[model samples]
Target: MSTNTPTPGGPSLPQERRLVTAIPGPKSQELQARKTAAVASGVGTTLPVYITAAGGGVLVDVDGNSLIDLGSGIAVTTVGNSAPRVVQAVQDQVAAFTHTCFMVTPYAGYVEVAEALNRLTPGDHEKRTALFNSGAEAVENAVKIARTHTKKTGVVVFDHAYHGRTNLTMAMTAKSMPYKSGFGPFASDVYRAPLSYPFRDDQLDGATAAARAIDVIEKQVGADNLAALVIEPIQGEGGFIVPAAGFLPALQDWCTANNVVFIADEVQTGFARTGAMFAVDHDQVVPDIIVTAKGIAGGLPLSAVTGRTEMMDSAHVGGLGGTYGGNPLACAAALAVLETIEADGLVDRAAKIGSLMTSRLHALQERDSRLGDVRGRGAMIAVELVKAGTTEPDADLTKQVAAAAHQAGVVVLTCGTYGNVLRFLPPLSISDELLEDACNVLDDVFAATK
Candidate 1:
C-alpha cells in the first residue's frame, strides 16, 4: 500500500529542503568562536561550521542554514542522516539497553553484526569478524592480525595512503603536516612504496607500476620480513585516486606469491560508497582481509576486520577487542545500513553519482586550466588543482575554491598528499536535483577563482 519512489514519497529522503541564512550563520559563528577558544588549533578543520540536524542529502547547520551535504559526515552517513529505518533501529536498541560489553556478556547484536560483516565482505569462503570503535582501531588490529598470521615484522604502505591518526596508523599514513608531523617517533618497521598514480607517473603501465612498488618493498624491507600489503582500492583522505586498472590485481598477486596478507582498507570506500559493496570488488581482487568502518554502521561508530577465518584466528585467545567495540546501538545501526544499501540500490546510485561528478569535473577541467585532473571510481571523485600549464600543484587555489564554495552555500572538502585536490563524497542517496545545484555552485566558484 506504499507508493514510494526516489522522487517524493521516498521513505529515506528529505521531506523538505530549506536554507534561509548564509552557511554557518549567526549561531554557527558564535559556536565556532567558542570552539576556537576551547579546542586545539592543531586539530585543523576543513569547514569551520557546526551541524545541528540532517536527513537524506541535507545538513542543517547550528545556525539553521540548510546546506546540501556532499561530504556525508566525511563519508560516514551514506544511508543518510535520520534515515527512517536506521533511526528506528537505533531507538529500538537504545530502549533495549545500550551496552553490556561483548567480552563480558556477549550479545546477539554483536554476533549478528559479525555475521553480517562475514557475509558482506569479499570472498565466499568462511570469514571471521572483529569489531572496533573506529577505522583507526580496525587498521591497527588488521596489522596485528596480519603480523600474527604471517609471523612477519614489516608492513608495507604506499606513498599517498591515509590509514588513520593513531600512533601506529600515523606510522602507516604518509602525510606529513597534520597526520604525521611531530607525531613521531612512531611505531617502527613500517615502510612506504610508490603508488600507481598514472596522472603523475605516466611513464609506467599498471603492471610495471606494481612491479616498481614490489621492487621497493623487496629491496628496502625484504619479503622475508613482510607481514601485509595494505591499500585503498580508491584512496580516500589522501585524494580520490583510483590506481590504474590492473594495479590491484597485480598487487594482490604479489601478496599471494610472497605469502603476505593483502589488506584492503575500505573504511572510506566500502558499504556501497564506491558502486560496489566493497571497492575491492571492482578489480576482482579479494584481499586476505578487508578493514571497514565509516558508512558501515549508518552514522554510529563501528568498524570490523573480516577475512579468512584462519588469519583472523591467528591471534591468541582474547588478543583483540575494545570496551565500546560493537556497542548494541551501533550494531543495530549497522544492520540497518546494510539493509538500506541493498533495499535502496544505493550501490547503483554510487555509480550514478560517479557518472554525474566525473562528467561535470571533466567539463570544468576542460574549461579551467586550474582543474588539472579528475579521477575516482563511483561517487568517490576528486579534482586536482594545478598551476595552469603545468602539473605543479596549486594547494592555495584549492583552498580558495573550498572557502568560496562554503561561502556560496556549499561545502566541499579538499585533500591529497599535497593538499591540492577537491574531493566529493556526497551521500549515494542524494537527489539529482540537489546534486546539480551543488555542481552549479562549484562552477560559479571556479569561475570567480579563475
Candidate 2:
C-alpha cells in the first residue's frame, strides 16, 4: 500500500479506529430509541450509530467510538466528511445569503457549477447543465429532456440497474422487494434489458452481451419509439457490476444510430469515486446526458444533468426546475468540491485507493474458495461471496462477516441483487495504514465465517 498521509486540508482527526464501547453503545442506543419514535420505519439505516462528527476516514458516534468509514456515506463524501474547502465555502455563502432561489434571482455559484460540469464531463461537444437536489431528480429531468429532444416515449434501462427511489425512478430500478415492493402502477414506456454481467452470464463477451441487449430493445421497445437509454457506467447498488469491456461503447453506438439519447447515471461513480473523474471516462464512452450527484458536493444534496447543448436547449424555460433545484449553499459546496478535486489531485488518489483495495481483496480471494469474484474500479470495489466450489450466493455468510466487522470497529456495507456482495467505498483522503487495518479486520471476519 502507498505510504501517503491523509490529504492536508480536512479537519484533524485521530486517523485510527477506536472503540470505547460496543458497536451500538449507550448513547447511540438512546438516539436509536428516539429515531424509532420520530423517524419512519421505512427509512432504514445500516448501522444505528448516531454520528456527531466525521472527517479523515472515521465517523465519531455519540458514544465516542471512532469507526473506520469504508462506505463514505454510500459514496457521497468522496473528499472526506467536512472537507475544509467545502466547509469554508458553505460558511461564507450562508453568511452572505442562504437562498435567493435560482429561478427567482439566480446566483453566480449555480452558474459556476454548471460551467465546471460542462467542462469536466465527457466529450468535446457543446454542453449545457441543469442542477437538481438528488440523483432521482436528475434522472427524472434527464428522461424529460430526452423525450423533449427525440419526440419518443420509450425509455430503456438494464436488468440489475438501480436508478433511484422516486415513483418514476422506482420504475427504472430493477430490485423488487425493497425499492418496488407494494409501489405499483409504475410509469409506462420504461423497458428493461439484460446487462453484461460477466460472472453470471456464462463468460459472455462484450459484443455478445451488447447484441443480446440490442435484440431485446429492438424487439420489445423498438428504437423508433425510444427516447433514451439510461445506465450506470459502473452499476452501483446492483453489486458494483462493471460491464464487460466494449459493452458500453457498443450500446453508445447503437443509441447514436437510433437517435436515442444515452444517459449515464454517474451519481455514485462520478467526482473521483472511481479512478477517473467519471466512470464513463474509463471506456471513453460519452453519453448524451450525464446525471451526477452523490460525491458532487462533498456531502451536500446536489445533482446535475449535463448534456449536449442542443438536447438540453430543447426543454422549455419554465418546464424544468424546482423550488430548491440549485440551493446556494449546495452550489457553494459543489464549487469547492470541484476545486478540491483539481488542487489535491483526487483523481490520482482514487486510483491509489483502488489499487490498495483490489490487491488486498485479490489476495483474500486466492485463499478462500467462498470468495467468488472481486470486481469494481478505483475506491469503489466489492467482493462477491459464494458457497464453496459453487457460484451460489452466500448471503448469510456475507451478513455474518459484515456484522463481525462492525463489531470490530470497522464500518462495511453489503449490496447486490443477490445480497451476497460486500462493497467498500473509502474516502480518497483515507490513509493507507487505516485501509490496511480495515482489511486486516475483514481478513479475520472472513476466516471466522469460513
Query: Top lDDT: which candidate number?
Result: 2
lDDT of 1 by residue, 239-312 (tens): 88888888889999999998999999999999998888899899998999999999998789999999999999
Task: Please give the lDDT score at residue 204 for candidate 1.
Answer: 66
After superposition, candidate 2 runs with Cα above 4 Å error: 1-7
lDDT of each: 0.87, 0.93
**What TM-score does candidate 2 get on C-alpha atoms?**
0.98
lDDT of 1: 0.87
Tens-place lDDT digits, model 2, residues 1-450: 223355455678778888899989999999999999999999989999999999888889999999889999999999999999999999999999999899999999999999999999999999999999999999999999999999999999998899999999999999996899999989889999999999999879998999999999999999999999999999999999999999999999999999999999999999998899999999989999999999999888999999999999999999999999889999999999999999999999999999999999999999998989999999999999999989999999999999999999899999999999999999988888889989998999988885
Model 1: CA > 4 A from native: 1-19
Cα displacement (Å) at residue 196, model 1:
0.2
